[model samples]
Target: MKLELLASFFLLTTCFTAFSQEKQDTAVADKGLIKVSVMYPYAEGKTFNMEYYVTKHMPMVAAFLGANLVKYTIEKGLASGIPNQPLPFMAIGTFYVKSLSDYQAAIAPHGDAIRADFQNYTNIIPIILVSEVVN
Candidate 1:
């Protein structure tokens, strides 16, 4: 019947619309990107505390700084070609921020607090980088 065919058409259109909207929302969420690499040189016997800092303290600081934690990764290898030399641990934390200035301002006030909390873990040198989402 024509009525049944019309009903089917409407249902199909509605489903497609919902799917399209969901895709758009996901794309928006994926648009913002911020990356920070924290280089750490740990003292001997402080390796365990370094793990604790990454797991527990870093998240707290990231939250306090208003950063949405996207992902965290670690890579270990020789700092140079020397086999016996201990390479520094790199903690790479990715986040999503609205803008560069917004990200800067968010952490400006907490500089001292952040340093105090993280000083026990290791000597940290934070490198901040930003990128655009291209898909």
Candidate 2:
């Protein structure tokens, strides 16, 4: 009878431990990574200074973001998939961050400066997308 009680207690402790671990894992997964994409739609007669964007503007933004920024990518929009078609976007910039709230807090103070810097790079107003990177 004592041996059976000991085994049952062990099983109950193991189940509780597994349940606790599963809950912790779920909490962490809920706070997944985030991606911020800034895309410039292609437009006739619009101007984009790729040099200023890459060399000056992006670096400045990255500085503002500081440690919250996991990494970033810049893509020059090439020809569309269909032949003889104009590109959908002039350029695309993406930033991967661990936490959306952290990214937001990092950039909140520099919002105005960031927006004001746009004229130095592109005439087209950029479209911004914030999404969770679920993979």
The most accurate candidate by lDDT is: 2
Each candidate's TM vs. the true structure? Answer: 0.49, 0.74
Q: Write the per-residue lDDT of candidate 1 for residues 1-135, one digit (tens) a residue.
A: 999999999999999999999999867776655545555543455443547676776776667555445544554433645676665544444555555576678778888887787666555555555676543
lDDT of 2 by residue, 13-63 (tens): 999999999988855654566889999999999989999999999889888
The positional error of residue 114 in candidate 2, measured at the CA in angstroms, is 0.5
lDDT of 1 at 134: 49
> Judged by TM-score, which candidate is best?
2
Residue 120 error, candidate 1, Å: 2.4
Find the 10 residues in a row with the least total lDDT in model 2: 24-33
| Clashing residue pairs found in predicted model 1 | none
Name the regions of candidate 2 deviating beyond 4 angstroms: 1-31
